[model samples]
Target: MLEGKVAIITGAGGGIGRDIALLMAQQGAKVLVNDVGASLGGEGRNAGPAQSVVTEIETAGGVAAANTDSVADASNAKRIVQNALDAFGRVDIVVNNAGILRDRFFHKMSDDEWDAVLKVHLYGSYYVSRAAAEPMKAQASGAFVNMTSTSGLIGNLAQANYSAAKLGIAGLSKSIALDLDKFGVRSNCIAPFAWSRMISSIKVDSDEQAARVEKIKQMTPAKIAPLAVFLASDSARDVNGQIFAVRNNEIFLMSQPRPVRSVQRSEGWTPQSIAEHAIPALRPSFHSLDVSADVFSWDPV
Candidate 1:
């Protein structure tokens, strides 16, 4: 579907990013696989992961190039995009799947944890998209598939930093979609539930936890790639500023943010009036503070 196109997929070392890169290449896109090759906690770095994916793509008769650059760095992000432009002479698609997990409860979360997570997921998306936007705008065509998370869309017990960054990404994508719509560029975000290195790192304690882990193992990261590929394809030209969720065999189009209820008083009400009148009027539409796990307590259908 992406024949002759050029795509830059960040975090393309392993997991969801790797799967997307391979799928995009198989669909005939020249892929620039970008991976800093960091661990799940955003520690250490290696070139093997990125290069391995590139080798697999090439061996499959697909065109791909490897880039070992950290998306967390603005200059490195620009370099990653530039690598794609230099190699393919045009930027057609960008998949901002690069991320790191510093899971910690909000109270226990350290400053470094917050900063690191935000830097990579939020700022990284901003820098890469910012660099790619100009080229895409000039070309008057492009697609962006940014990685968001249910943790952000809903909420999570731990992972305050991650949730914040993911939510920011969703907002950024929507704004980008609106800003670049005139240029014929589209932007969308996805909250993917897949078994990857990041997911596997979660500690399994009890028998129930073990069973849950096993079930998650069946939800391979590869299963999440097709949706991303489709979103970046010409077939989804009219789709923009939307959010989606992929779990096992299920794909969900999430509702965008909108006001659910409103109350008005002709005579400008005070705080007391708001608490007395408006609160009751809007109570029925008030959503519970349920996290992703709470809402999706059942197994993936």
Candidate 2:
């Protein structure tokens, strides 16, 4: 389905990015493997993983190239996309799967820790997508799939920064999809629950963590790759501005708010009036806007 396409995959060295890149290439897309080889916490690195993937793809008779540029830097982001264009004649798909985790409780979170995660997960995607959008716009056809997580959709202790960035990715996806639709470019997001090197050696501090890890362990990162492949394929030409959660073999279409309930005041509006009349009925449903629906009816299906 991805035949003859050129795809740029950030953080393609390993984990979900690696899986997505290989899957797209196996489906016949020439892939650009971009990875800075940063550690799980976005610190330290080696270039081995990035180069290794390129070699593997080449050995398998697939067209692929390795780029060690950091996605968080705007210039490096453009350089990575340009590298793909230089290697292949054109660019068709971009998968922003590069991310890092800096976990800490809200009270104890350091400014550096918060900034680091935001830079990678939010700004990194922004930089790369901005760079890729130009080529996509010119081609009048392209797909952009950003990696998000359930932690962001919901909430997870010690992951405030990560969650915020992931949620921001969803917002970015929707906005970009709206803007790029005129150019026939699609933007979407994936909230995947999968196992990867980042969490392979992680130590669970409690039974809750153990249970959470066990639940996610059942969902391999490879299972999530097919959705990405589909999104980048021609079959998804009409599928844009959507967010999907991939776990195990199941693909869950996430929900968003769409003005489902707007209880206008029969009485004069005031904080006191809202608290008295609206609070009871609206509180439960208001917060439920975060995630509750088959798929958001914001626009079409």
Which candidate comes out best when scored by TM-score? 1
Please write out the lDDT profile of model 2 over residues 132-249, one tens digit for every residue: 9999999899999998877787765678899899999999999999999999999999987678886674579899668666766766778989999999999999999999987677
Each model's RMSD to truth, in Å?
A: 1.4, 4.4
Please give, for residues 245-265, the per-residue lDDT of candidate 1 as tens digits.
999899999987788888888
**Poorly placed runs, candidate 1 (over 4 Å):** 205-211
- Per-model CA lDDT versus the true structure: 0.92, 0.86
TM-score of each: 0.96, 0.92
lDDT of 1 at 290: 92
* Model 1 RMSD in angstroms: 1.4
Error of 2 at 48 (Å): 0.6
